[model samples]
Target: MGYIAFTIGFIVFFFVLAFLSTTFSIPADAMLPIGGLLLLVMIIAIAAYAALS
Candidate 1:
């Protein structure tokens, strides 16, 4: 279902971000920009989904 896929994608998104951060030793200062970008992407995704549904 769409709901289940969305939930899984949300979890996977965070997991991949965490893994990449740890693997690359991302700096704290960079996190703000990265988080902002992710937030923007999330908002766009939710809005698009809502419009489609």
Candidate 2:
């Protein structure tokens, strides 16, 4: 169970990192807000999944 969770989180972390790197060309200042919003969305998604399960 721990391994599964770790693997999923690892994949998601890298996926998001790659996406942000490739998709955004803005400055770090601009990216700060975007990253925060994406993090919030990710948290919400995880919370929703937990609630549904």
Candidate 3:
């Protein structure tokens, strides 16, 4: 029950942040690079977690 509530709240927060970003004048091409960087960070985090455990 607690985890479910937390998940809902986290999703709500994400959408709120996404709505706020809509007002910005960001370029579409920038997303590819940012997404790639985030993906790299995610991979590194998972690798480190696996190595530690």
Candidate 4:
């Protein structure tokens, strides 16, 4: 249940970033780094969960 929630939250975060970037004319480069970092963090969290569980 926690994993599911984390996954959903991670996805929503990126989608919101993308939407905001498009709506606000944010530079692709700036958005890419932020999105990438979020994705990286999510991946690490999931991997840690898998390894420890």
Candidate 5:
């Protein structure tokens, strides 16, 4: 349950970052790497939780 909540939080955080990136016209190269890292972290967290469960 905690892990699920954390995953949700991370997703929201990622989207917020994305929104900011777009709204502010962040450079593609920087935004892409950061976004990819965030997504990768989210995936890894979810996978870890699933494996543990």
Candidate 6:
């Protein structure tokens, strides 16, 4: 259940980012670094969650 919630939240986060980028004319080049950071955070979060569980 917790994993499912986390997955849903992560998906929603990307969707929101996508919407904002399109609406605000955020450059794709700028988004690359931001996306990489988010991916790193997601990996760390999952690792921490698994360790705690």
lDDT of each: 0.76, 0.69, 0.56, 0.81, 0.79, 0.81
Worst 10 residues of 1 by lDDT: 1-10
* Model 3 TM: 0.51
Candidate 3, lDDT over the whole model: 0.56
1-53, model 4: which lDDT tens digit per residue?
A: 66785778787887889798989989988888878887887788777877777
Better of 4 and 5 by lDDT: 4
Best by TM-score: 6
In candidate 4, position 36 carries an lDDT of: 81
List TM-scores for all candidates, in order. 0.66, 0.62, 0.51, 0.54, 0.55, 0.67
In candidate 4, the residue pairs with backbone N, CA or C atoms under 3 Å apart (3 or more residues apart, or in different chains) clash, namely none
Q: Could you tell which candidate, 1 or 6, scores higher by lDDT?
A: 6
After superposition, candidate 5 runs with Cα above 4 Å error: 1-14, 22-25
For each of the candidates, give the backbone clash count: 0, 0, 0, 0, 0, 0
Please list all clashing residue pairs in model 6, or write none if there are none: none
What is the descending TM-score order? 6, 1, 2, 5, 4, 3
> Once superposed on the true structure, which residue ranges of model 2 sit more than 4 Å away at CA?
1-14
Please give the range of 10 consecutive residues that has the lowest summed lDDT in model 5.
2-11
- Taking all chains together, the TM-score of candidate 6 against the true structure is 0.67
Model 2 Cα shift for residue 43 (angstroms): 0.4
Q: Where is the poorest 10-residue window by lDDT in model 2?
A: 1-10
lDDT of 2 by residue, 30-51 (tens): 7677777777776676666666
User: lDDT per residue, candidate 5, 1-53, as tens digits?
Assistant: 86676768687977878797889989878887788787787777777877787
Candidate 4: Cα lDDT at 35: 84
Candidate 4: minimum summed lDDT over ten consecutive residues — where?
1-10
